[model samples]
Structure formats: C-alpha cells, structure tokens
Target: MENAENLLHKGVIEGEEGALNQFYYGYEANDPPEKQLSPPLKSKITGISLKRGQRVRLETPGGGGFGKSSERPLEKLNYDLEQGYVTETKDD
Candidate 1:
C-alpha cells in the first residue's frame, strides 16, 4: 500500500499520517495479527510448508478524509450511522 494521506482526519488506520503501508501476518483463530514494519515489497518463498488456516492481512494506502466529522451534514451522518459506516458517539 502507498499514497495514503489524510490532512485533517485520518482515514482508517489510527495514529498513521501521510502515505504509508501496513502489513500483518498471523494464523487463523488468532485474536489479532502482529504488525510488520519494513516488510519487503515483494518476496519469494521456496520449500516452505504451511499448515492450514494461515492468513495474511494487507492494508493499502488510500485518500484521507477531507473534512471534520462535526462539520458533516446531518443527513449524510445519519446515513453513515444507519449503514454502520460510522457509529453514534455520546458527548460526555
């Protein structure tokens, strides 16, 4: 992944700013996969045997959000909430 940037607010990955790539690898049924930094862009594996249920997760870079959440229109916000894209938050 590359070219992921958000000016004001982040897109999905937390605490990440600008264009970056994130990679994760773990076996199935694991609660969470470990983050891999500086992973090779391409790799070739030979003679490696693997059991079933192995998985790898890759997050590609993408365009960042354009505006603030508070400034979003009510209708759009409501639609996002209803569609499970955004969750409702309570002010403390």
Candidate 2:
C-alpha cells in the first residue's frame, strides 16, 4: 500500500487541462488479447493488490504546452502535422 498524490499537472492556459495518468490491469481474450482497462485516476490511489497472472500498466501524461496554441508558429505546426505528431482540423 502507498499514497501517490498530484498524479497529474494542470495546464497553464484556459481550456487546457493536462492529461490524466492511467492504470490498467487484468486480461481479456480476443483476436489479439487485450488488457482490461480502467478510467484515469486523477487523485490518490491506495491499497492496490495484484495476483500471480495479473498485471499493471501505468501511462504517464505528456507535459503541458507553454503558451497559447495560436502563438505557435505555422511552420512548426505544419511539420507536426506532416510527421503525424498532430492532425489538421477545421479550427486551424
């Protein structure tokens, strides 16, 4: 048992919330076996236990952007799209 807090950070700008970390466990049988999933836990998690065949996965969130999206340069944004790091949308 352990106490983990502030698992996620807040975004600097408005409408920009940092991604929440995720924890997954268990197994499911399918064409390709898949791990059973659980919702992101934004707060503290305690008293977790695991069995012999069970597993746990921890997905950490990416860092928050520094400033406004509109302030980003077009060239860099274009490159992100070209390289599949970002996707183009009607809003842009």
Clash pairs detected, candidate 1:
none
Worst 10 residues of 2 by lDDT: 1-10
lDDT of 1 by residue, 20-50 (tens): 4554554465544343222443333234333
Best by TM-score: 1
Q: Global CA lDDT of candidate 1, please? A: 0.51
- Candidate 1, superposed: residue stretches over 4 Å from native: 1-19, 33-50, 81-92
Q: Which ten residues in a row have the lowest lDDT in candidate 1?
A: 1-10
How do the predictions measure up, each by TM-score?
A: 0.43, 0.43
Please report how far candidate 1 places residue 22 from its true position, in Å: 2.0
Q: Candidate 2, residues 31-63: lDDT per residue as tens digits?
A: 233546564464666666666767666766665
Number of colliding residue pairs in model 2: 0
